[model samples]
Target chain A: MSQVKTLALVTGGSRGFGVAICEQLAKKVENIDFSLYARSQQGLESTEKLIKQIKPSANVNLFVADFGDIASLQSVWSQSLKKVNFSEYQRVWLFNNHGSLGPITNVSEYVFNSFLIFIDMDQDHLSNFKEIESEITLNVTSVFVTSSLFLKEIKSVSTPIETSVINTSSLAAIQPFDTWGIYCVGKAAREMLLSVITAECKDTPNIKTLNWSPGAMGTDMNKEILVKTKDEGSKQFWEDMIKNNKLVDPNFSAGKMIDLLISNTYTSAAHIDVADA
Target chain B: MSQVKTLALVTGGSRGFGVAICEQLAKKVENIDFSLYARSQQGLESTEKLIKQIKPSANVNLFVADFGDIASLQSVWSQSLKKVNFSEYQRVWLFNNHGSLGPITNVSEYVFNSFLIFIDMDQDHLSNFKEIESEITLNVTSVFVTSSLFLKEIKSVSTPIETSVINTSSLAAIQPFDTWGIYCVGKAAREMLLSVITAECKDTPNIKTLNWSPGAMGTDMNKEILVKTKDEGSKQFWEDMIKNNKLVDPNFSAGKMIDLLISNTYTSAAHIDVADA
Candidate 1:
């Protein structure tokens, strides 16, 4: 019977589903130290307060990070790691929960009208590639870099520790959306990255991975999707969900995720939606 | 038909499947003008020779450019388009055929021992992110940029031209391969990009797109896969493939792909493999 101390590293903990995930983890994981990273200090503090109120004794450290800025991202991640003693914990959880959909716009200079192949693009088309590159760096590159770093750094610890890597995936990972083109690509790519990790670590039962898709949620993200989406049917579908109040709560979705990790019932490296779970 | 002159632009036209595809297009398409881009002038020239030997009157222009260098890519694409009068042709084909398997190694610092999660990364680990980013830029970013630019620039011609954006995809696009981590992600992402395009132009049958997977071809890529792959079972499978001479010929595969294009029966934006086609 070894003593168990868990290290829950959560990105995007400042707000939305990230905050909910932090709060859920706070209530569930006993004797846990949270390394919460996000871009906003104020938001991180608020999440910290919520976490502390739930588990007063939980030790939480916040790191302000901009995933789009790789230089700052590297500095932030390294700085966060300086204080951590990996051997002090028997369990490590890496939650790749941070992502962005960029601008909910058309694929490029094309404004996307069916049957109309050519339309005059605006001056904004000049900077389209820049936006596309930045969005990709944030959504796709950061996930790969962070997960690789986490596995590398954490595994360096001499002692054997159970590890779980949870990817905050979406139905978008498997399905394509019209205006959400880049978002869908990023999500789909991230899903495959997890699948590769799953295949590579198949024999290692302790190193469990799951792509957890939190269903359409009542979050700022959903609000953005509803507002900026270009596809009428897609927009109407989401608007209906909002009007019907049918969206999943962030906390409820986070609970399912944490429960899946705790219950250890999910097939490692498989995508399990909150609805299914 | 008043006039239908086809312009076929193939990347990776230096050798292997690119050459085969160019050859097939030269043989099949009447009054075809070929604009071929690749890193090797010799190889593109070879492909051009093959095309000219088949269709003696085929007008071929070769651009030697590196997809890895975005500056050079822009220059190359723009240069290739400089001499072209858009209205001269009724069909424009942009073949996103160039991609890299990168180093057929593990994802990152992790060597992937299944049970052993961490191993000391070499000094090469310092450059790992650089490689990852570059591979991504070449495979995923370039595909998006090129396709966007092609659709945008070519559509401005005002005259109705039948355009086909053919993405050189693979089974890797749908299945995750152990050592081919970035390749798999890039392919998968490209597949979705076409899907988004498909959805965007559902009513525009003139704007055809296909994710043409050429199958397990006997090309330089296959040789590299055989040599560098880290997984024993995967390597064994490929080795058996080589031993049994089960690899698809590049020309045969290319013929299948072009035939699918000529037959025009594949669902828009669907992945159509050579064997399946």
Candidate 2:
């Protein structure tokens, strides 16, 4: 591998794990250059300030974009690359850590009512159907757009060494939740996409595409899902499930991810589940 | 398992494979009824006409609504269910086959050769980083929103047997092509969704879900992709491979699907790779 400093791009870097990913990349990778993508301009600026505070000489830049919109990703990614002098960097580490969780109440009510009625199912309704469609778009389609754009870049770059594409998938990618059909489906597709990348870019040894399930983290997305459902009884239940069995702190997860980036042991362009990692 | 006629709701049943699914159901199962969904009034009429022509006494009702639109699905599904007299039907089979294939192009061309390059990677055009975002709403977001709503119905339904959701995913769902990122990502997420269903509903056997890859049929979508990509330089490769390997026709493939559905032998709510099937 070349000895050029690694360049890192962290999406959803405005808060939570994204911030952690940015910080860790700056500290771990020597001569690191960073581009942080997030929706909020203020968040982006704040993140940049923090990066600069940590390493005044770090070539840190902020790009505001919404993963929900394909255009934002297209613009943000393209603009970010425009500033890079790739010759200076030996390896590139792309960390896609942004995602949203929502539409949580559609199932708990069904489960509760079914428990009461002793009926296995609820009467059919259409409103919930539409919500699922929206969620799939926000969760899945956006990932495709972003990944597709990024992968294209990885393939085209004239770099001599290796480049890694790390997608932020979820354990939920393999497992489903009660009302999280939309989210689950999106993540599942992402896993398949990693497989596809594995097959398509089999010859592209210089590029390692992977969907990394950072496991569950105590992020806003986790809290958001809880708030959407408004379930007091199951709050502790979910928290316990995460704390006891599922959730991993963002910093710990980010550190592990940085290790994976440096380890370079994953030879196939397939998704690496964190539980297994 | 119930002797009562099976009730199937075929979204986008006006024509194409959706109509084919309806016809196949009528011929294969006795006393089967279909609630057909389509946005086009003429398409619905055509489906009804075809159903009447095929089986003079087949009980087929038309529900007019855009499956791509969330609110439309809600209104159409609810109103249509009310009219159907739910007591009459025993088990529900939701064949979600309605969808569209969006633009095919690399991220650069789609976004005007912008965002195609990342910072430090393409410093030549660093000053002109601002580029227009892709118009992804109509082609991608619409399907996601509607599917999300449909999933809600799947979660909420109270039928004796869990509703069967067979999403019409594509080979693209597993792989990314130059111009089909939007469609691929949307379907990819849905694939994960079924996994989610499998994990969450392990105890609940009523709902049978499959992220089906209906092998590359000579459908309109395939034709469009082939035409757009000039056969993607792999048509001959696939055709030659299939001919040499004696690949089965789509009709035969559909037969295997019907067999799987009726026999219920393949019970795991796992992703049944159509290629494998």
Candidate 3:
């Protein structure tokens, strides 16, 4: 008889914390299969390679999908399902981690950019409406659709498996972050989405949803905040954190996240900060 | 010179609370102009007629715009701005009242529907990806874009005027309503958008944003909730409220909302429930 394996699907499983999560799960969990989705093929391939190096017997699948594009996301979801026989898994987990910081600037600069970009700003600029829409789509709407798809896939399995959705949230979801307008709203929406899903799935014993804030991690996202932020105060704060070595290590944060997920320490619709994890 | 008028722009201003708001404002506030946007021409025309009937000399303009469509919204916004010079208004108010109740069903039925619709559901059904996208765009993104546009318009004026955005919100923004997944997320997103805007505009003394929760009102939205909801508990609750005549009158709620807007009693990003108003 074949052994039942655990299935873990993660979005944004290319670089930064995503790669750390894949590596941590590969090292910690035995007989687990991974399905990773990201926009960059190179990044996904490298992460898959790292996971294979960690667990030589682990089965890793990489899918290229842009969360900002619904069509691309749907295509990847369908393809991933075809590659994995979900019914053979003893447990299923979906980690929603893909996000974008959008435009970061001071309130004055944002207001100025709104007008500047309104008249002549390039469409590709971060300040444009299209970019804002893409950020919101990638950060919030994509999670909503992808998580819904994951739930549907879980329901399709003949045998009930332990299932959980760990939504990668941020402190910005609760607190106001100046100049990260779209990102803040998107994270807040994600938290609310998990809340609604958690409430709706209360009767369904097999499924659980949680919002997990990974805390201040030393990832590419943080690097972008430090380098690309236009707000002097915000830039200084991030710089100070980096200089003081205060940012959480990606590997450590990933391990804590996996621990919470495996232990099922949080099943309710609440935000779980890494410190609490 | 003609007296400077107070201009109010309302989305979904054709029926229910929107119409009530326009009527109440027309009757109560003198030297005020109205710009109403809605997809239904008949509704907008009738609303304009009612407003004109109430105030014979009032200037009421009706614009056809579907909140779900960005192009339509931009066209209407431009047309409205062209019609009314911003400098002519002593105060500019935007009522983000347009919204949609995405889907209403019990968890079991929703799961069943998900499976039923999973294979054959048009990608555009409320349960499908497209519908969810549209609902979010209409309920959340439209408000973001419109409010941004309002800010831009306000900036174009030579003289500064008191500007406020009163976002019509719901209890679902904070609470989880089973089967109303997208609606709940959208409302929450709206609240967060208001929050970000409120924070960003803190130093800008001219602009203020408020999320107004128009409690249980006997409007079409409430009737739909009572009739279409598949959640037994929620349906029962609404039915009890109706049976007990507990739903607030639309006119009364509108009056309270307008009073809050004019008085600027609530300047913060907090959710202002109608009962508190």
Candidate 2 stretches with Cα past 4 Å from truth are A1-3, A106-137, A151-161, A225-234, A241-247, B1-3, B39-41, B101-162, B170-184, B198-204, B230-233, B238-251, B273-277
Model 2 over residues B1-277: C-alpha lDDT tens digits? Answer: 5476677778778755676777677666666777888878898888788767767766888888764555565566666765655445556677777776654543323333435456334222222212111222333334344444444455544665545767767777667654454566557665655555555566667667765667766555555655444334555754564467554454555556666677766654555665687
| TM-score for each candidate, following the candidate numbering | 0.89, 0.79, 0.91
User: Candidate 2: TM of chain A?
Assistant: 0.82
Q: Which stretches of candidate 3 lie over 4 Å from their true place?
A: A1-4, A105-128, B1-4, B105-127, B156-158
Off by over 4 Å in 1: A1-3, A108-126, A230-236, B1-3, B71-83, B108-126, B154-160
Clashing pairs in 3: none
lDDT of 2: 0.63
Write down the TM-score of model 1's second chain. Answer: 0.90
User: Whose TM-score is greatest here?
Assistant: 3
* Per-residue accuracy of model 1 over B33-93 as CA lDDT, tens digit each: 9889889999988888889899998889999978876656765676577678878888888
B-chain TM-score for every candidate: 0.90, 0.76, 0.90
Scored against the native two-chain complex, candidate 1 gets a DockQ of: 0.46
Task: Report how far off residue B274 is in candidate 1 (Å).
Answer: 2.4
What TM-score does candidate 3 reach?
0.91
Q: Compute fnat per model.
A: 0.42, 0.35, 0.44
Tell me chain A's TM-score in each of the predictions: 0.91, 0.82, 0.91
Error of 2 at A31 (Å): 0.4
Q: What is the descending DockQ order?
A: 3, 1, 2
